[model samples]
Target: MDWDKLRIFHAVADAGSLTHAGDTLHLSQSAVSRQIRALEESLNTTLFHRHARGLILTEQGELLFDATSAMSRRLDTAEARIRDSEEEVFGELRVTTTTGFGSLWLAPRLPALYKKYPDLKIDLMLEERVLDLPMREADVAIRMKEPSQADLIRRKLMSVHMRLYATPGYIAENGMPESLEQLSQHRLICQNVQATQVSAGAELVRELLTYDVRSTLTVNNYFGVLQATRSGLGIGVLPDYVVEDFPDIQRVLPEVESKEVPVFLAYPEELRQSRRISAFRDFVTEEIIAHRKKMRQESESGA
Candidate 1:
């Protein structure tokens, strides 16, 4: 039950070699061995099966090692939390979102955040996979739909629609499709109906596919679709938000669009007071405001 013995046992079990554990702990091999022995004797169990190469944990040892490992990790996290500056917004913040949004929208706006919090470290995890914010898989998430996970503080950010777009060159060459029926004449670029994407987007792609488009380029993510569309590949089914960044691409088939897909920002309820989370939340809020303003101005100018 001694803490020191448990610590030595964890190091030894992790390394599986007494000399290696000793070297890591800055203790002699005999001393490390004594600690392990005393711990095993106290628990009345054979903690290890020793061989010439090293040691393997017995079932009992495995159980004890699991406990010690958890303890060690918790302690390390505690130490890190303690080391954080309570008054400053600084530390690693793991942010997760779909690749399309991260790369097209959020990633481009990060320089302002970096300017404000030069010390802050941001790990941007861009994927379709929804990371668990409550379990700390990621510190924050900006998702296409509201996260239904428990114990999360969620905020509605905006709504986006899946609309058809094509580069000027492509439209000029192929002639723009004026109606849904006419869309079938041009190659459609979009996310595969079965690919991991927002349901609304997939549904839009499915509906478009039903029009019997003769040729298609289906990418897994909107980023890929956008790149193909930019290259004058075909008419791309993409989120309306992308138009804010890519102004040259004109919308096609004005009546053909998906229902609005709501976007949400979520974080763990337990992180309500985390300074890093607050800073990031505020920064994103500001960016969203600016983005909306820019879009409004563009809309007005075009009108």
Candidate 2:
């Protein structure tokens, strides 16, 4: 099998048009067609179906395309690893995490990371859906639960709990709940039980709903709940980590909280030696350590 011909076939399959693939490869349409023909002959299979509009992949073509796509992603990972400079953490680091944690915690601390590594390029992908790390869908991930993917080097970051919070102004006007039974008197703000979230949070919301709450405000994400709570809307179910950054948000019925949700940071084992990964891992570990220390100091002083 000729490497060049396979490359051309991959391009043609990707573009679905011989002319478009030729343009991308900077080759003439006839030359591109010749290579595709050669590849098809070598494989002894009809790779595509010719149509008036564009090329559609045959079953064999789909299999080949899948293989080529994996190759492309592997090449990209290799390129990134090769580009990582020794003794310098400069290059793109694609980090994925839930929107709530990314926006609330990690994003706020990224300035520190940028200051230390000025040339570092960070592509933060925030969504609830877990990306495939081994497939190179993302470079690293910070997730609410431990990642069960094989070949991943994972580190437990910290644990978070869903707790009730309310702005001081709201508490001042509505008073505070002395116990879980008293929560029925005030409106509840939380993530909808049906939305995708940590199981503990949804369980907590389900348990809270049983209190016969008078009013309810349900948002899909914690950010929306936090915003509503900050606006004096109602008592919100939020993670305890927010307390450090939002001192004005007072804990309500501190005893009423969800089970602990463990947070983990994971990356492919292949990236273990990459300087960028080491830098990011160290930075996040240092930040979590500092956060724990500060929270302890505040607690001691308050005690």
Model 2 stretches astray by more than 4 angstroms: 1-84
Encode model 1's per-residue lDDT on 34-141: one tens digit a residue: 998888889999999999999999999999899999999999987876776576677789999999999999999899898998889999999999888878999999
Model 2 misses residue 227 by how many Å? 0.8
* Candidate 1 minimal-lDDT segment of 10 residues: 81-90
The TM-score between candidate 2 and the true structure equals 0.73
Error of 2 at 188 (Å): 0.7
Q: lDDT at 162 for candidate 2?
A: 97
lDDT of 2 by residue, 203-238 (tens): 999999999999999988888889999999999999
lDDT score, candidate 1: 0.91
In candidate 2, residue 263 scores what lDDT?
96
